[model samples]
Target: MKKIRAALLGATGAVGQRYINMLDRHPFITLEVLMGGESAGKKYGQAVHWLFPDAIPERFAEAQVRTARPESAEGCDVVFSALPSEVASEIEQDFAKAGFTLVSEASSHRMDPDVPLMIPEINPGHLELLEAQKKARGWKGAIATTPNCTVTGLAIVMTPLLDNFAAEKAIVTTMQALSGAGYPGVPSLAITENVIPYIKNEEEKVAKEAKKILGAVKGGAIVPHELPIGISCNRVPVIDGHTETLYAEFPKAVKPDQVARVLERFSGLPQKLRLPTAPERPIIVRRENDRPQPRLDRMSGSVPGMSVVVGRVRNGIDERSLQLTLLSHNTIRGAAGTAILTAELMQKEGYIG
Candidate 1:
């Protein structure tokens, strides 16, 4: 099988760096173009500030960065976008109109009714929306997005619970990592000693996007989950993982052991197809009381950073409520890795072949 030629848009930010790392040795996709804004005319190595622990790959180090224009990406089979939401809305559509499939990490299109806000294991069915999107927009290609990073962990954990126990309401409080803010993020003086309790528009994104991700696709449209979700987002000093505490009210009583059993055995389309980036266990249940901490569990999974580590599953204040803490690598499973996995599913389903 020939490798698909791909382009990386917004190739000089935190999320963009993750895309570069994951695509460096990807089995099915080749990084053929690098695009950026101010960094457009420089070599990738010179343009990027280089935040990741791993050294930038030599193959891409000397590749010239180009402006993110459709013509610059003409021959690529797919475009992996990490552009800011404000800029991505227009540029991603331009690429789609110019006949390129876009697997994006931008928040701009996550709520669009026609675009698929996908979690391969949780909502592979939503990809069907792409057909409607292409038809409605009159484009040869389409956009598929992963939800906001904060929403990713929340939605993944909620999926199994909703399937086996059925949720009536959910409340998630998050301690998101500093890297989520992007490069030159929150001044050290502000974040080093204290936790900032708000992220502009984060809480709303988590609440709304979760419903869409866990929603059902019907009659050429997605029917969002009716379950009510409330969220509070905070920015912590940690560098990589996002930790969330979930409290849910299920319709009926469910024991901790039952919830653990369902989460431990959960697997979806990515696992069945054995996509390279998919973790063997999407959710790793920890029996210890002090587990799932960002320092220790952020890298949990066979594919490191691909799994969500869950702990402290117990009854809440009442028999109908359950509480637990979950941790996920914000940049990997929450952003770039999920986008890559979505593209893999597209290939398997004949949407991108």
Candidate 2:
């Protein structure tokens, strides 16, 4: 099988760097193009300021970075877009029309029925709608996106319960890392020792994206569920992982141990597919009381690519709900890792050549 040649738009930014590191050894993809906005024209090594401890891989050192525009991405079989939402909406649509499969991390096209915004482990079934999307838009390729980082982590924790029982509503509070905003994101004065109670559009993204990800695909389109997620999104001074506290009310009465068991042992459709980037466990239920801390365990092997670590499971306010704390590598499992899994699903399903 010929290797799938791919491009990374927004390749000079934080999320793009994660895509680079994840794709460094990807069995199915070749990093054929690296495109950025202001950072265009530099080599990948120079364009990117390495933050994560992992060194930049040799394959990407000399790769030239170009303008992250559609015309510059010629010859790629798929384009994993880590571009900002506004920029991504434009470039991704053009690339899809140009006949390249677009697995995007941007939220622009996420709500479109034609575009499948996915967390492969939680909702691989949604990708089925991509066929109708392509035909409707008269495009050669389709777009599949990962939900927002907070949504990705939150949804993974909810899936097993949603599958076994039914999720009535959820009240969540997220302490999102500054990195979610991008490189040089929050200024020192703003976040040095502060916790801003509100993030501009994050709460909306978390609420809306969760429903789309948990939605079902029917008649070649997704019908989003009417589940309500009351959310509060905050920007913390933390550098890497985003942590979320959730109170999920289930229709059935399930214990904390039951939730732990479900999260600990559950592996979804993506794991079964054996997608190269799919983690063996999508959600790791940590037993240690203080586990899943950003500095100590956020980058742990549980997320070799696709896992989300969830710990501190306990009873919620009432008998009908359960409380848990979850953590995910903002750029890895939340951004690039999910994008890679989306591409793997597209490849196995023959969306890409």
Candidate 3:
């Protein structure tokens, strides 16, 4: 693996900090440039309201944050964006036009017919759209995106069920961590002792993004899966993992034990290639009745926080439906980790150098 110069956008935000934390000492990818808005011209360590208790890496701690623009990323091989949706749209596209391949953690481009909403483990093939994206958009570079944090764990769990048992519908309810709302998230007064049952546009993003992730690529475009997905999202007091309960309907009766086996055995292209950020098992199945709890299981995996932990597998309303609880670290498996993994796959497949 050649050393890959990397640039980060929104470098002072919550997910952006995760990118820095995870990339320190990375074997190949180096955090070459940090880009941001208000933080621009300031040192990264001083600008960021660091979330992780571990100290910021010394080198990045002293690195100057640059203005969010393509020129600031002058020599990077790939860009990792943690920018918010409202402003990320234009800024990211500007980077794409300037010829920098990017893997974004924003909602703006995920649904673009040409932009792949990626989950490396679920749809590595969708990256094939990049070439088409360049041609259609008339840009020197292209962009790939990771789905919303809530959708990340849900989509990964749905893949095996849909493939192995022909699951046709999914009903999901998510108890999302506070970190998911971004830095300086939900005021303590509003969320400390309460569960906010609504997160604007979250349920919609989950359903739509999950389908695209579980979809197939054909004729240079993704043919979104027609699976019916119903989701309800809530912001919980928990600070990191997003926990989701999934009830899936299948054409044929499938036993809980059988479902567990398939999920436990699930692996994808990244695992096959042993990508640095890919977990040994993309999904970890727990047999204990009260397992997959956020604090204990959210980070469970060969690569900590990269696997989806699933438990409470059981028969649903009927034998043809199955229910289970799943959890993943919102900042790791659901944000920076997946984006970094996608970049690894892109580099390995000759999309980025």
Candidate 2 off by > 4 Å: 302-305
**Tens-digit lDDT string for candidate 2 (24-121):** 87887888899988879988888788877878887687878888777787888889898899777877888888787888888889888777888877
Question: What is the overall TM-score of model 2 with all chains considered together?
Answer: 0.95
Arranged by TM-score, best first: 3, 1, 2
Each prediction's Cα RMSD?
A: 1.0, 1.6, 0.8
Best by TM-score: 3
Query: Between which residue pairs do clashes occur in model 3?
Result: none
- Writing each residue's lDDT as its tens digit, candidate 3 over 195-236 gives 999999888888888888988888888888999999899999
Q: Which stretches of candidate 1 lie over 4 Å from their true place?
A: none
Clashing pairs in 2: none
**Per-residue lDDT for 350 in model 3?**
96
Tens digit per residue, CA lDDT, model 1, 1-353: 45788899998999988989998988998889999999998999999999977789998899999999998887888899999999999999999999899999998888889999999999998988999999999999999999888888888999999989988899888999998888988999999889999999988888889898888988777889988988889999999999999999988888998898899899999999999899999999999999899999999889889999999999998988999999999999999989999988888888885
- Which is the winner by lDDT between candidate 1 and candidate 2? 1
- Candidate 2 vs candidate 3, TM-score winner: 3
